[model samples]
Target: MGKKEILVVDDQPGIRMLLTEIFTSQGYRVTTAETGQEALDSLYAGSFDLLMLHYKLPVVDGVQVLEQLEKDQFTIPAIVMSGLSEDIMKESQQFEIVKEVLAKPFNVEEVCEFTRSILE
Candidate 1:
């Protein structure tokens, strides 16, 4: 089988770089996108095993991206990260496709572990 591919979408370059390094170091094929539309475009162009998305993405929010993906029948797993409160996370959980909700200021190891757990 080929290397697992992961898409990391965030508006911040620093965050995208950090995630790219983390996933690439773990032997995963990594792709970075700065906006939700870019993420969707990337998704349409290639296959990915998972998506790591920032909740407050520009052009389209994480939920919107997930919705679009579902509408298009793409079933890849997703991890949504946000600095929002627990209440907001709970609200977002109404979306069935979200595999996990990660709070901001999270540990890098935790993110890697979650991604590994889901993909592996």
Candidate 2:
């Protein structure tokens, strides 16, 4: 099979870069979006195996993006990342696509293992 593709969506440039680099190093095809619109655009434009989304964003928040996915009937799996991870986790329980909630200030190895567990 081809390498798994991951879309990393975050308002924070550093997080985006870090995830992109980490995933790329692990032999995945990674794309990044700084906004929810860009993430949705990427989702509509191509195929991705997983989504790593930030809870807080300008204009279109992560929940809004997940709502859009439901509206469009996209079944892509997602991991929601947030400083307020517990709040988002509780709120995101309704979305079947959200497989996990990752807290910010996360461990790099944990991120890798989680991705591997989900995709592999």
Candidate 3:
């Protein structure tokens, strides 16, 4: 297979940069968006193997993005990142596309490993 493409949505520039750098180093093609609208645009424009998004965003937020995707019948496995992972985890269970919930300040290695396993 070709390099797995990941769409990472986070309002925080640092978080987006960190994940983009780590995933790129690990041989994944990473695209990032600062708002949920941008993420939705990217999702609608092209194909991606995975999605990683922060729960709190500027306007649309992560859940809104997922809801839109669901409404459009766009299916993609997602990892929801949040400082409040426990709560988001419970809330995200309702979305079948959400395969994982990651807490902020997470280990890069773990993220890489999980992503590798998922794409593999």
Tens-digit lDDT track for model 3 on 1-120?
A: 788899999998999999999999989899999999999999999999999989998889999998998888878989899999989989999888888889988988889877887788
lDDT value for candidate 1?
Answer: 0.88
Clash pairs detected, candidate 2: none
Query: Alpha carbon lDDT of residue 50, candidate 2?
Result: 96
- Residue-level lDDT of model 1, residues 82-106, one tens digit each, is 8883854786677666788888877
| Ranking according to TM-score, highest score first | 2, 3, 1
TM-score of each: 0.94, 0.97, 0.96
Q: Give the lowest summed-lDDT range of ten residues in model 2.
A: 105-114
Per TM-score, the best of the predicted structures is 2
Evaluate model 2: give its TM-score.
Answer: 0.97
| Local accuracy by lDDT, each model | 0.88, 0.94, 0.91
